[model samples]
Target: MSIRFAIVGCGRISERHAQHISNVGELVAVCDIVREKAEGLAEKYGAKAYTDLDEMLRYEKEVEVVAICSPNGLHAAQTIAALQAEKHVICEKPMAINPYDCGEMIKAAERANRRLFVVKQNRFNPPVAAVKELIDAGKLGQIYSVHLSCYWNRHNAYYANSWKGTKALDGGTLYTQFSHFIDLLYWMFGDVKEVTAYTANYHHQGIIEFEDTGVVNLRFYNGTLGSVHYTVNSYQKNMEGSLTIFGEKGTVKIGGQYLNELEYQQIEGIEIKDLPPGNPPNQYGNYVGSMSNHDHVYANLVQVLTNNGIIATNGFEGLKTVEIIDKIYTAAKPL
Candidate 1:
C-alpha cells in the first residue's frame, strides 16, 4: 500500500520532498500560500494543489502523510494541525523556535496516535552511517569527547532574497544550517546536560536579527564534553563539517562533508595506531550534499509506517533538537 503525502509550503526545499514522494510514494497534494508554487509542484507530480492547508485536508482524503516545509517558526503549528487532522507529519529541521512549541506539537501527535518524523536526513549519509555502525558495534569503546565544526559561506544576497536572515522566521545559522549537526550531536552522543554559547553577526552585514557566526560548548549527560564551532563566512565558498569522538579503547575521527572521512585509532598497550581505511568520498563532486537525498529517508519512513516499526526521527526527537537549540540561543542572548 502506498502512503499518500500532502506537502505544505512549496518553498525551495519542498521541491526536493515532492521529487522524493513522486519517486517513492503517492504524491497526493501540495499546498502553499503562493498558489503558483503549489500548483507548480502539483503539476510536476500529477497531484492536486491548494492555497489553503485546511481545504487540502478536507478534499484530499487520501493524504495520509503531511510534509511541513514552511518557515522554521511555522513548523510547530503546522505539525500540530496536521496531526490533529489524523495525518502523520514530516517536519523540516529546527523543529520549532522554542521547546514549548515543540512540546505542543509532540503532544498533538501523541493524542492523535500518529507518527511525526523530523528531517534529520544528514544522518543518512553513507560515511556517517558507517561510523554509526562502528560506534554501535563498540569499535570506539567508552566514548569521551567530540568536536563538531561547520563552516560554510552564505552571502548576504542569499539571506536577502528569502525569510532566512530574520530571527522571527528562519531563526539563525544555528537554526537554519547547523541544526542538522546539532541533532547529529545528540543522535550520536545523547542529551546535553548544559550548553554555553556565544553568537555574533560579524559578517553578512544586513538588516537581519540573527548571527552568522557562533560557538557552542556542550557537556553531555554521560560526562562527555564537546564543542560546536560554526560560521557562515568564507571567501572561496567551502563546507567543513566533521565529528571526532574519543574513547577508552580507540578514537574515531570522521571529517569532511557529511562526515565522509573516517579514521579509527586504537590505544593498544604503548601507543595508538590507525585502523583500516573506511569509505571517504571526494569533497567536491557530491552535488546534492545532504538535502537532496530525501528518497532514502522517506523510503525508510514508509517502511516503518507500513511494518509497524518506529519512525527514525519521531516527534520526540524533533522536540529534543528544538530544546537544545532553545537552550543554546537563550545562553547566547545578550548578557
Candidate 2:
C-alpha cells in the first residue's frame, strides 16, 4: 500500500510536490488559504480540499505524510501542527525562517514520535552527488576554500502582490532563492564558524524589504574559508548558480545555472563522467528555480517510511540550513 499524503500549501512549488507524491504515494488532501488553489489541486488529484490546514489534518486521518510547501515563515507552525496530529512532515527548504522555530519543529516531531524531512533536493543532483562522493573519498583532500554564486532574476512581477519578496513570509533572498546552495555548502563543508557579509537591495529597493544582492565571507568549523555572492537582480533571467571547491589535492566546480553540470574537474587521477542525466530546473513561468529533484525526495520518503531505509535529509540537517542562513543575515552589513 502506498503512503497517504496531504499538502498544506497550494502554490507553484506545491504543485511539484503533489506531482511527486502522486507518483510515490496517495495525495489524500490539499489545503490553502485560497480555497480556489486548494480546490484546484484537489480536483486534479482526486483529493479533498480545505482552506484551513488543521481542518484538513483533522479530517484526513489517512494522511500518513504532510508536505509543507507553504511560505518560509509558515513552515514551523504548520509542520508542528501536522506532527502533533501524528503525521510525518516533508518541509520545503530553509526548514523555517529562523533557527529557534526550526528547533521547535524538531521537538514537536520528537514528541509526536514522527519523522521530519526537509527538502534539500538539490543534493540529489548527479554532479552534486558525484562531487560529494569524491569529497568523502578524500579526492578533494583537505579543502581550503570554496565559492558559491547565485545569480537569479526575480523581476517585479514575480514578487508583485505575492509572498515572494516580503520579510515576514519570504525571509530574505537566501531563504527563498539560494538556501539550497547554502545547504550544499554546509553538506560538503562543515558548519560555518564565522560570517561577514555586506548586502544591498540594489534593483529591488522599493520592492523587497531585504537585500536582493549580497557578498558574504565564511569560515567553516574545519577552518576552511569561503565566499558567497548572491543576487536576484541578474539581467532578464537566471545567469548562474555554481559552487567551486579548492582543496589540497584537486579542484572541482559544479556550475551551470542550476548546478546541474560538472563544469570543471581536475582531481588527482579522478574525473566525473557519464553521470545519469538529471531532471531539468523547475520552470515557474518566466523564472526558474533549482533543479527538479522532488521525485527523488518523495522516493526517499517512501523508502524510509515503508522500508526502514535511511532518510536523505533529516530535520536536524534542515535546522542547520536555517542556522547558517540566520548567521549570514545576522552578520550582513548594508552596502
Candidate 3:
C-alpha cells in the first residue's frame, strides 16, 4: 500500500518534497493560495490543483499524507486541519514559531490518531548520523560541551520581495534560517536546562523584523554546556554551518557549507571509518541551502506507514526543537 500524498505549499522547498514523494508515494493533489503555483505543481505531477486547503482535503480523500511547506505561523493550524481530515502530516522545519502552537499540533495529532512528522532532514547527513551513532555507542563518552557556528548571508534582496524576515509569519533568524542547526544542538547535546543570550539585527535592520545575529549559552540536563553564535550577515556568501562536540573521550567537528564534510575527528582509541558522502545541498532558484535529504525522510515515512517502522523525527522531537528555540528567544533579547 503506497502512501498517497498531497502538498499544501508550493514554494521553493515544495520541489524537494514533491520529488521525494513521487518516489515513495503517489501525489494526488497540490494546494496553494496562488492558483498558478498550485496548477504548476499539480500539472507537473498529473494531479489536481487546489487554491484552498479545505477544498483539497474534501475532494482528495485519497491523500493519506499532507506535506506542509507553508509559513511558520500557519503550520499548526494547517497541520491540525490535515490531521482532522484523517491525513498524516510531515511539516517543514520549525514545527511552529512557538511551543504553544507545537503543543496544539501534537494534541490534534493525538486526537485524530495520525502521525505528525517534522522535517529535520539534516539529521540524515552521513557525518551527523555517524557522530550520533558514536555517541549512542558510548564511544564519545560523557559529552562536555557543544558549539554551533552558523554564519550565512541573507541580504536585503533576498528578503526584498519575500515574506521572510517578518515576526508574524516568517519568525526570526533562529526559526527561519538556523532552526536546523538549533535542532542539531538539541539532538546532540540533550535537553536544555538553561539558556542566556543576546541578539542583534546588525545588517538587515530595516528589512527583517528580528535578529540577523545572536549568541547564546546553554546548559543541558546532563551537565553539558553549549554555545551558539549564528548570523546571516556574512560578508558576501555563507561562511559555514558547523558543529563541534567536545566530550570526555573525543572531539569531533562536522563542517562544510551544509555539514556534509567531516572536517575533524579525534578519538582516544577507536577509529571512525567508511562514511558515504552526504547528500548534496538543496539549490533553490535564487540561493543554495541545507543538505538535500528529504528523500530519506520520505523513505522513512513510507516504511512507517506501510511496514510499521517508526518515524525518524516524530512529533515530540519536533516539539522539543521548537521548545528549545522558544527558550533561546526568551533568553536572548534584542541588543
Residues 1-335, model 3: lDDT tens digits: 77789999999899899898888878989999999999999999988999999999998988899999988878999999999999999999989998989889999999999999899989999999999989988999999999999988877888987779889999889898988888887787789999999999888878989999999999999999999999988887888999999999999999998788899989989777799977888886556789999989999988888889988998888888888989999998789
List the candidates' TM-scores in order. 0.90, 0.99, 0.98
Q: Flag clash pairs in model 2.
A: none
Q: Is candidate 2 or candidate 3 better by lDDT?
A: 2
True-structure RMSD, every candidate: 3.7, 0.7, 0.9
Q: Evaluate all candidate structures by whole-model CA lDDT and list the values in order.
A: 0.78, 0.93, 0.90
Reference-based lDDT, residue 173, model 3: 91
The clash count of every prediction, one per candidate, is: 0, 0, 0
Global lDDT of model 2: 0.93
- Select the stronger candidate by lDDT from 1 and 2: 2
Q: Give the local distance difference test score of model 3.
A: 0.90
Error of 1 at 276 (Å): 15
Best-to-worst lDDT order: 2, 3, 1
